[model samples]
Target: MAFDVSVIIPVYQRQELAVSALRSVLEQKGVTFEVIVVDDGSPDPFVLPADLADNDRIRLLRQPNAGAAAARNTGVRATSADWIAFLDSDDLWLPGKLAGQLAFARDGLLKGWPHLTAVMCGFTQIDLPSGSRRHRIPVESWNAAELAAGCWFGPGSTALIPRNAFEQAGLFDETLMRLEDLDWFMRVGLLGGGVATWPELAVTVRVGGRPSVKMLDDAVGRMRAKWLEGGRVDGDTRRNLAAYLALEQASARRHAGRWLGFLGCMTRSLLLRPRLRVPLRRWWTEDPAAAPQ
Candidate 1:
């Protein structure tokens, strides 16, 4: 069957989580879609759940362990549909996610809006270990300038992008181990049409994993060098990106229980951009006296 959308799921080692993710995709109603599960050379090699093993709508591909970005690009190349949606092996799509995004994209195309590249929706992030949930809604507009400052498009799972956008913006940067979505979206935003976002929650992201400090540092350094010091972006964009990177490092340090490092990053973040006082205070302390004033 010619599918309306192709769902790309990149899996690493979590076989059980991959099964659940695929089930959630199959549960999506009002849309005809195909599921492509790319196994990124898991040590054990992923096998589909028995029930879905013979399902014709799903295809499983295996490749040497490339990052999620490469896996997604492979899936896109194999897709039979014009629209593509990404679902991490650990994430699940909420009901109406595919259908609603499709409708929104079609409407934008009908209206001939040049800035409509992809339709994104809000999502609920669940910290699996803590069982804490946070509902994140996308802002009304997400242009290049806004994306460079921060990643407001939620996660890769929350976007429904057309195939052409990938062709024009280029596929995800395989070199980026983290923040590949942010990097790719930045390019898409530069295409004159920024991403279209809605407030409706559409995906459930299971979080809890933390990257090593060294890994985070490396990623941040790459981002800063590319977007900030490379003379590729505007002055405001550089400042915003620098501030965002500092805050991100601060958050990572806080999560890793590195209080001193956290404080330093927070201070740098504030010094780079005083407008970040609200976030600085929130990250520092809720108490008026304790928080940065």
Candidate 2:
């Protein structure tokens, strides 16, 4: 039977979490979907649970240890559905996530909004160890210009995109170990594809240790070269991206329990943007261990 959506899961070393993520997909109702699990050469080879091994709706593919971008590209090639959704091995989907997003997309199509290449929903970030829920972002729409300025939502788990999006925007840049989502989304926005949101939380993203500050700086530098060179992005967009990167670095430092680093990043973020300076200044006064509400 034809499927409404193809859920591609890219797994690296996390086997247990991969199984749990698959279970969440299996629990999804009100949608016809197929699951493709691409194992990026985990040290301990991924095997389906005994019960799931006999299930025909799920397919497992194996490849050498390429990064998540390559694995997702491989999965996209094998997908038969017109719409595609991606879920990392460590994240999860809430109940009816697919059905609701699919309905929203259909509505957009009926309203002649073919430029709606992707539909994203809100997601909550849950910090590890403490497992405390951080701030919840409600879904909101963004035009091409707004998206071109900066990333606004979680794309890996919460995005339901048409297969053609990859064709037009191009696949995820395998070279980017970070910020591939932002890069791809910006390309989509440039191609006249506007992003819409479902206006509800539909995914849970587990936050863990982040890459080092040096690594993040390197990634941001690459982005600056790619987008800001030769006046591709205007001055406002450049500052917007700078402020966004600083805030992201601050959040990473906060998650890693580096107070001085967090403060430094926050200072740069607030200085560059200044719109949210007062509220964020108050946020810094709170306990560092406490997750943002």
Candidate 3:
């Protein structure tokens, strides 16, 4: 039997968390979906529970540590489902997540919006150790400018994308260890279909385990180069993106306790776009310890 959705999970060195994520997918209601777990050659092998080990709906594939982007691409190639949903191994879907997204798609199709390529929903960010919910990311649609500014989709787990969107936008960039979602979403935003948002919390993202400052800066730099290549972005958008990336670099430096580097980045960012001076000043004045991790 054909499934309505294929859930792709890219896991690396997190067996227990992957199991928890898989259980969450299995608990989804009102949707016929299959789970594909692509293990990116984690040193510690993922050992499935006995019940799931024998389950036909769930399949696990192992590949030599190609990172999340390649693992997700592998899962896409392995699945036959028309709709694709991605869930990070450390994150989870709440009950009715799939059902709600399916309903949203059905309504759009009924209204003659056949070009709807992606649907995203709100999510709650939970503090890892305490498991306490930190905040809810409200679901909202984004235009090209909004997307270019920053990632608004919450997390990969909150999105339900059509197979065609992947075909059109292409897979996530394997080179990026971070902000790959932003890159992919920006491409999708450029496609003119516009992402649809459901305005309901459908996923819970565990906060912590964030990448280091150097990794983030390198990744954002790569993303900036990719976007600016071939004059893909106009002048105003390019400036905005530069300022945004500069601020991201500043944040990374601040997180790493590099006060001088942080101040330099902040100055460069404000110079790129003088309108950001007020916010940059405020940010510089605030205690770095109070900043979001």
Candidate 4:
């Protein structure tokens, strides 16, 4: 039987959460869907969940520890469906996620929205200790320009996109450890696809402290490079990226007590990033103007 959707899940070291994610997928209603679990070289031996063990619809593939992007790409390749959705191993979905989103996509197809390439709705943010709390993005819709100027994937779990979009926009850039989804979203935005949102419940985004945060300068520098390489970024986008980068770097430097370095970053970011100009101006207006120059 042809499935309505294929849900791709990428897992790393979190096996328990992954099993729970599989259960959530099993609970989804009104859609015949397949689950593809690509384990990103977990160190522990994975015991396939009980519900998945006997089922042909559940496929588990093992690959060496590449990053999450590569793991997700592997999962997407094995799944057979027109519409592809993703839920991270640590994240999950509310029941009926597939049904509602699939219906929304099908209706758009017939309603002169042939260009619809991706549909993402709201999602819950699951706190590791607290269990779960629903979290949603403020925007209900996006166009190529809006998404390009700002980054919004609506969280990877909430996005359901056509298989064809990946074929055109290309797979996620594997080089980026951080902000890979943001990069992919920008590429989709550049390809001129209709991006519509349901503004309703979609998936649960699980947040936990696994990998410790990196140094601010290193993270921002990498993200800036990734965002630039992925899109047809205009002057405005460049400006935003630059400003963000500068602010991040300056703040990091300031915290480290490198006042001279902080001033340089603040000036560069504030100068290039007009969006931050007013706020930063007020911040530095009282201080020594000598630092920025």
Candidate 5:
């Protein structure tokens, strides 16, 4: 039977987590799909659990140590499905993830929500080791503007999209090495295609080493570099993208003790969105006399 969606997982050293993610996909309730695992050159020679490896729906594609973007891109190219879902190796889905997303897509189709170009679902943040302490984002409508303006995304793992849309948007930037999701999503947004999010938590996004603060900074820097590398812009998008990149830079700079840099960023933000100038004006008030705890 042909699958409705292919869940692609890019695996590195986290074999156990990858296996668990695959199991979660396999356990997806009421959904007919296949799990495609891209072993992104994991140094560890951990093999898939034999008991589950033989399953027709779970296939592994071995590749050299390409970045995660390359791995996922290869997986997308190899899968045999019109729709594709992305899952990070370390994240796990709720019991009904695929079913929920597919159902959402079907409803959108019935209601004529275009081809349902993209679908995003919410996620629960989990602390590792014990995997305890869960916090979910408050349910809210997925705002395209907010996503474009740069807000926290639980994970790229949440996206379920039409294969054709991805074809149009092109694959994740292999050179990105990180922050590829936001970069890809931003490019996808530029295409003027619609993106939707389910708002309901459908996956447990593990936040430990992979999604670290440093990783975020690195990704943002890379994204900014790429965003500008596209050359001169002739629209509101360039204005907004520059401002957003500055905001990201300012925040990073503030954390790095570059007060002047931070101010410069705040200036850009205010410049881009004049209305925000009045509200975010006092972010520089520093506390001078705090004792070491």
Candidate 6:
């Protein structure tokens, strides 16, 4: 049977979270969709429950440990749906998420805008520790410069992209273990197709679980170099990107207890963009005492 949308979920050693994500997709209303779950060689293996195993709407594929980017690419290749939406194994789509995006597309939100090839909705980030939720609304429209300033798409999980756009933008960079979503979105922007936003929240993302700081730093550093070499962004956007990268490096250093390195990174970031507000705010809020003398 033909599907309106193909939901690609990449799972790696997160069986329980993946199962929950699959259930959320299965429960979506007003949209004919199929779920493609790619198990990226989870060490312990991923097993679908008996109920899901027999469901024709769900397709499970497995491959050696190739990271989330590869897994997503594999899932995309396995589907024939015209529209593609990605959901991280740990994230869940609220009811009507797919229907809402389809409505936006049918109502000319994308058709009226020549540059828009995708639509994404807002999302709520649930702080795992405190159970507090913060709603985030990404920009309704964005150009390359705006995207270079930051990852305005929020996350890969919130986006519903057309297959043409996906093909043009190419697959996510497999080398990037972190910030892969941002990298792919930046590429999409470079391809001259922007993303439109739906104001309502469509997904709930669980946050607060931390990964290795050094690894994050390396990934961001690689992303910075890649964009720089692409030369798609202007001087101001490049400066902003540099400032953002520096701030991320500083945060990583701070997390690693390297106070001096953190201070140095913060100083460099400020020098790059003296009026940069994010680093200054993070400096004061994260550790006022560690602020440079």
CA RMSD for every model?
Answer: 5.0, 4.5, 5.0, 8.3, 7.1, 5.7
- Report the C-alpha displacement of residue 156, candidate 1, in angstroms: 1.1
Model 6 sits at a Cα RMSD from the real structure of 5.7
TM-score of 5: 0.78
Compare candidates 2 and 6 on TM-score and give the better one: 6
TM-score, cand. 6: 0.88
Which stretch of 10 consecutive residues in model 5 shows the poorest summed lDDT? 284-293
How would the candidate models be sorted by TM-score, starting from the highest? 1, 6, 3, 2, 4, 5
Instruction: Report how far off residue 266 is in candidate 3 (Å).
Output: 3.1
All candidates: TM-score = 0.90, 0.86, 0.87, 0.78, 0.78, 0.88
What's model 6's lDDT at 132? Answer: 79
- Give the top-scoring candidate (lDDT): 1
Clashing pairs in 3: none
Displacement of the residue 160 alpha carbon in candidate 3, Å: 0.5
User: lDDT of each structure?
Assistant: 0.80, 0.79, 0.78, 0.71, 0.71, 0.78
**Candidate 2 residue 126 C-alpha distance from true site, Å:** 1.2
Looking at candidate 4, the ten consecutive residues that score lowest on lDDT are 283-292
Q: Model 1, 278: alpha-carbon shift in Å?
A: 5.7
Model 3 TM-score relative to the real fold = 0.87
Residues 112-175 of candidate 6 have per-residue lDDT tens digits of: 7644467878787787988876677666545665565556566788888888776788888899
Q: How many residue pairs clash in each candidate at the backbone level?
A: 1, 0, 0, 0, 0, 0
Q: What is the C-alpha local distance difference test score of candidate 3?
A: 0.78
For model 5, residues 1-293, the per-residue Cα lDDT tens digits are 79899889989898788888888888887878988888888788547898997798888888989789999999999888888999998888888888888888777768766462577776666767566745443222233343345534447788888888777878888876655765666666666655665656688888674343365567767766666666633355555565666676676677667798789877878788575443322212112232111
The TM-score that candidate 2 achieves is: 0.86
Which 10-residue window of candidate 1 scores lowest in summed lDDT?
283-292
What does candidate 4's lDDT look like per residue over 19-101, in tens digits?
99889988998889998989888898556966569898888899999888898889877878999999888787887888998
Best by TM-score: 1
Q: Can you write out model 2's per-residue Cα lDDT over 91-175, one digit (the tens) per residue?
A: 9998999999999898987887656468877777787978787544433434444564445555489889999989888898877
